[model samples]
Target chain A: MKIYEFAQAPNCRRVRMFLAEKGIKMEYVHVDIGKGENLAEDYRRRDPNAKVPVLELDDGSHIAESVAIQRYFEEMHPEPPLFGRDAKEKALVEMWTRRGDFNMMFNVGMCFQHTTGFFSDRMRVFPEFGEESGKKAVQFFSVLDQHLEENRYLVGDYFSVADIGMLCSLDFGKAVKLRPDPAQYPNLVRWREELNARPSASA
Target chain B: MKIYEFAQAPNCRRVRMFLAEKGIKMEYVHVDIGKGENLAEDYRRRDPNAKVPVLELDDGSHIAESVAIQRYFEEMHPEPPLFGRDAKEKALVEMWTRRGDFNMMFNVGMCFQHTTGFFSDRMRVFPEFGEESGKKAVQFFSVLDQHLEENRYLVGDYFSVADIGMLCSLDFGKAVKLRPDPAQYPNLVRWREELNARPSASA
Candidate 1:
């Protein structure tokens, strides 16, 4: 399998981290977003959304969406499962993963895109929306902090895709200078420290 | 099992349609969003995000996120599988589901929240952002139109959660007056018509 990804992209990092955790190796093909290569017709044929982190199977079929790519990997490699071991566990992991996506990752991406106009040439940017999104991202930190206070991980004690999602989102938050204040979000700060120390963090 | 939901919420409707398709019945508890009931402390305890369509299992534990809830149902009732029958099919369904969420559902919700100011009392509303989001939602309709032109459903010939997601998003689009024009998006228009004819559409 070959993965088309843009290094440093949050969603792309998510798949990389998952692959690292599962000890899986695949051929990597970089789709340089900085050069607008992903927007080219050939790349768009692989992913209509023209987004990075697309997994191309040996069958020549491709799967877009980071979480979906992770799902494909999980289904193929059930060991060291990142989703869950059972129905309830899967639901919990999925719940937190969605929370991480909606509350942090998506908001942080919006904040970066709107505030920095990083891809303004391709999409419209609204500064006010960006600022508000940054605020929303920071607001989610407090909620995550509270959740982490009693739990070891996003979904209880297990390290799963939820943590992976959170890690990627928090790292991406740096792009917009949206970090959790240690004094206000100590638990979240501690959690980030622990996750950053992981081997997959560098992936 | 019990589901706490708002009848008109798009995410909530996704789960409702899923249950309808599966022919599964569960206790329904309405948490009126317009009445500020979902914001109550007790409701927040059930779902920290305080969003509707929370599924409380028989074990008293709850799961938030429509997709997660749908997964729980899918695991419990495998008949008429909406996710997919095989690994590749599952990946396709999930890829399209994520697309529906990002390109269609989220944009339609943003358009409603920003323009209609439906929840302006609690959150800031930027009319410009809302208008831009509406345009994005409409743009996605064209993309969906092109995809539906070649496939019977969002994933392929079989109906799946991706279809349910697109159906819910398009219905929610009505709130922001963002519907696909038949002249411009005939495939999308035809797909919507067919989906609307299903019994689950009223769910």
Candidate 2:
């Protein structure tokens, strides 16, 4: 299998971290998103959206979307399952994962895009929207902090893709200077500290 | 089982349509989001996010997130599976579902929020961002149109949650007057027509 990704992209990092967790090895092709390489014709053919972290399977089929790629890996490597083991467990994991994606990851990404004009050459930049998105990202951190105060992980006792989702979101938040304040979001701060200690966290 | 939802919300409708497709019956409790009823303390206790389409199980536990709610039902009733029958198919279904959510659904939601101030009682609105998001929704329709021109369904031959997701997204697009133009997105237009013909589409 091969993955076309941008190393620092949060979405791409989510997949890489998942792979690291599973001790899986695959060919990694860096897509220089900053240079508009992903928008090239060949890459566009692989993923019409021209997004990073496109996983090409051994059979030549490709999967986009970070969570979908993680699901594929979960199915291929069932041990240390990052999704869940049962119906309800899976649903809980997915619920939290979606929350992290929409509330934190997506918001932070928008904050960066709108504020920094990181991809201004390719897309319009709205600084006002970026500021609002940055505020929303911080608000989501409070939500996560509250949840983390009671649970070891996003769902429950075990590490899951939801945790990875949070890790990626928090890491990406740094770009927009939306990091959690240790005093204001102690639980989230503690959770991030622990997660950052993991080998897969740095992957 | 019970579902707390607003009838016209696209995310809520995704679950309603899924339930209709599976022929599952559940008690429906309407949450008047426009009236801020979902913001009530009790509702917030049930779902911290206070988002609509919260599925309260028979045991009183609840699941949030439209896709997660759909997955719960899919696991409980495997027939007429909306996820997939195999790992690869499941990944494909998830990938498309996520795309529809991120590209079409979320953009339309933002456009509605930013332009119309649909929730002005609770948040800020930015008309410029709303217009940009509306354009992005149209661009996503073109992407879907091109994909549908080659494939019968979002993934392959069979209908899946991805179709349901697209259906909900297109339905919500009507709120922002962002319907797919046949001249610009013929395949998407055709696909939406067929999906709308389904009884579940109106659920």
Standalone chain B TM-score for every prediction: 0.98, 0.98
Report, for every candidate in turn, its global Cα lDDT versus the true structure: 0.90, 0.89
Docking quality class, candidate 1 = medium
lDDT of 1 by residue, B92-192 (tens): 89899989999998899999999997899899998998898899888788788988999989887999999999899888999888878899999998999
True interface contacts reproduced by each model, as a fraction?
0.67, 0.70
TM-score of each: 0.98, 0.98
Return the DockQ of model 1.
0.78
Candidate 1 positional error at B172, Å: 0.9
- Residue range A1-203, candidate 1, lDDT tens digits: 89999988999999998999999987899888988999999998899889999998888888999999988888888789889888888889989998998999889999999999889999888898899999999889889999999998998899999999989998899988998889999999999999989999888
